[model samples]
Target: SAGRPMTAINSSYYAATAYRSDRMPNQPPSAERSWIRRFAKFRLPWGLTQEVALDDFLIRRKPSSLRFQEEMNKEREEKQKLGTYIPAPYEHVNFHDRHDHESFRFSLWSKRSHFWIYLTGGGRGLFYIAFVVSMMTYFLMLFALDDPWLTTTVELLPILATWIFLPLFCWALGALVIRYLPHLWVKPSRGPIWEINRRTGLVTLFDYDNNGEYKKNGTIGELTAPFYEFDAYIATIPDRQGLVTNVLYIAHRYRDIVINFRPLFAPGEGQLCCALWDFLQNYMDTSRPLPDLPRYEQYRHLDPTTAEYDRKTRRNPRFWIDMNDATFEQELYAMRGKIDQIDTFQRPNLMARHVEYVD
Candidate 1:
């Protein structure tokens, strides 16, 4: 059942794998073909990799893992030296405590909406094309017309209005009408699509079917599982062109629910996804402080664990929000380099004690 107590889960058949390691076992591409139909066209980052069984790896949450701890410590020291670090500007696509101060909701809805808009060719693509064509037509008219500059500009106005402005206006008007019409009649999402509630230790996923016509149905669309019941996996799915895409996903041990993690981290390489998995574990574990990322610095005081951790360590609350943009960007570059050098496979699987295995 959904949202069952974590203690009720006694075992799993999958072997736990280190989150940082990209070494995946070779398995059949067709292992997940049944469910793959729904996500066949998901435009995730692609690279070459060996195809593996979808369920082959169970990535455990290991906040205490040595490499995770070391990298976090390094980040802390570097940021402190860079001056008071300020949290980056808030974005709708990532984690936020807006729903509940003690909880963090991770969202991909904005990105999903954008994807649909662009897929239909009615987003920036339409506006950009309209602007470019209008400019070219204006220049062409100036060269061909015999009138003086002002007269030519005046004469071109009607032509531009008929050939460009009116059509562009119609397209923009249609897009807004289409986008806003549903909201006028249909109810919006009942809750955030993905959320990790630190106070309750529950992870929620509001799953929506493929159709973009309607919002998620009531209780049938919701799935809430204990954070401990979730395991991360880096799925190496090959597309029709034979290019493999490495994407991160979180799945319930005993439920049919799976959350696509690509929109959050937007990992281009498999290793970045591993790092994000490490950070996510740290974020969810109430026993530990929040991962010292620029994004979470502002919310440190809201989470009990993080507040206490900051107090004990005498951490500056505005560690990220106060830094200059130039310095922050430099540190980001340095951090990326450090992340690339991280040894993902060296740490032993720390979920050994928490997860029971069945023969």
Candidate 2:
């Protein structure tokens, strides 16, 4: 009875159970049958000769059914022997969740410490330069005077005064400016340098918007802008070993403070500049084990006598300043020249990369 087709049954149970009461409603055709009819127009050849009932098709009485059962049993036995079915290939462990917190803490400490060191170095450099120039000027004055007593007196007084008083005055002034000038302290016009975390990669410039506060022109009846805001990235970079390398400096000119003077060196500019100065101090201290990946390494092994590698190998990695416009080109050039002279002893390469005028 289990193997018999229900189409031949006469009982009410059979009628009630029919797929469609009017036309075998309770029993629908299998997907295989539907697929065969749908693509029958293609005239594809069939491997089996006869249409078989579902019950008989799955039983071992039929040759195809017996073969299918044997294959299935073999597969079952193999899987059982293997303990459990496992798909090919294994998953990799995600290390981010495990080490993220530690990495973040270390990065934060490094950035803070580095920034402090950088500021100290910059401040010392500034003081040293001022001292050197003052001393040089004093000597020149002595030579020009051609009077032994006056020259000696003038030289000694300024040297003693500078050594004892000038540094204190400058330090006090710097502290006062940093504290009282909150607006100027964080302002973008100060050539604000920013350092993003070491893991984030390069910081990119975003939109710049100008604040409405402006100075007015008397005759032209025009309003002068007072502040500019830039939306920029705070990003970090990684080293070859997947470790945080250094923070990146990103400049975004979101807004401009248009004043009577050239917008470039206006008062608001101090904020940006100071911010940059602050950031540079931090960056120099934090960024370490400078990326020394050999440039043009691919061509190094091509020939024993390749001139490109030979030249590059002898030269050290260089750092260059990139400027936006020609307006600041002269200032940046002078700074680069000064840096070159200072770094002459170390022989570290320094240069500038200037961008073209945009508007």
Candidate 3:
């Protein structure tokens, strides 16, 4: 069912939550754990899909909901005064979710239009299951033809060809649909840079070239627009049988941004995706008005982590403020300094594969 149509879970989940910071302050840690449970009870957010439910939860928890809204207000005001959407060259958004004194294990970033969402967990299970089903279907087709197993090369040729070409066509069609359905449809695929510019009232995307320059500096293959256009949607990329593997980002243009939210369809993926959306929607207040920079400025507070992170990275304060192509390269070089190695994390508890050949 991955190849099925993009089930509309929320026609405007991201858009609707943009300015609703008032409700975000009082939520406790336990509230996040039970959000899915609560949603199931109410069937809320409308257009519920299994994928959306999982992702929305994770995304919502990544940034301190309190801090995220606070920063959103700051950036919104800054954009209004400048009349441009350029990011604060020095502003760094860092979060360290730590316990037992291990310090921050994750380095998820989102400041103004910049974001580094952790979308690397879950989805392989569904894909492996889908692969198994494809194999099962192939065998069934062969058996229905009254064909013996590997009995003759001549007869086997047609069966093998059919098995191969059929899935190939399905995969191709799925890719085509995901790639070309532009202007308020799915984005082309996922890359590095993402931005929702309140200043210009547009969402911009940049290709992830290895330049290591400031996140994005007028790069090639740019995708930008107010994606609330007709035909803009959130759809999935499918395997041969059209089961969802990734949710392609769709807006006014086919931004090549496909999120692999269904690698095995683990519940964890949905969480990460949801968290990403939460960070993104902060910048995507479509009805946001200009001005009020002073109001946002007042909310800015001195963060304790700033000094510690600076020392950890061993960089100067002004170094970040004067970000450019060359400085980005230098910072990457500095990060290569050796650190203690962590234990290898095992993943993939199960797999799907064809029968192994015997000697």
How accurate locally is residue 285 in candidate 3, as Cα lDDT from 0 to 100? 27
- What value of lDDT does candidate 1 attain over all alpha carbons? 0.52
Instruction: Give every collision pair in model 1.
Output: 85-319, 85-320, 85-321, 86-320, 86-321, 86-322, 87-320, 87-321
For model 3, what is the error of residue 155's alpha carbon versus the real structure, in angstroms, after optimal superposition?
Answer: 45
Residue 45 Cα positional deviation in candidate 3, in Å, after optimal superposition: 14
TM-score of each: 0.53, 0.20, 0.24
Best by TM-score: 1
C-alpha lDDT values of all predictions: 0.52, 0.30, 0.32
Candidate 3 lDDT tens digits, 103-218: 11122233311211111111233344555665776667667766566654455556556655555555554445434532223222333344444333344445455364435673
Q: What is the lDDT of residue 42 in candidate 3?
A: 13
Better of 2 and 3 by TM-score: 3
Angstrom error at residue 189, model 3:
17
lDDT of 1 by residue, 1-359 (tens): 10111221122311233111122233222113244533533212111111111110111111223245457667877887998655433323233224333565654334544444444455346556767787788888788877787898887777666665544665665567546653332222334667776556677776555344234434325577666666566777775677876787776656677777776644356766655565555445444555565555546787655666677779987666565657655656665675576444454444434444231
* TM-score attained by model 3: 0.24
Q: After superposition, how far is residue 127 of candidate 3 from its true place, in Å?
A: 22
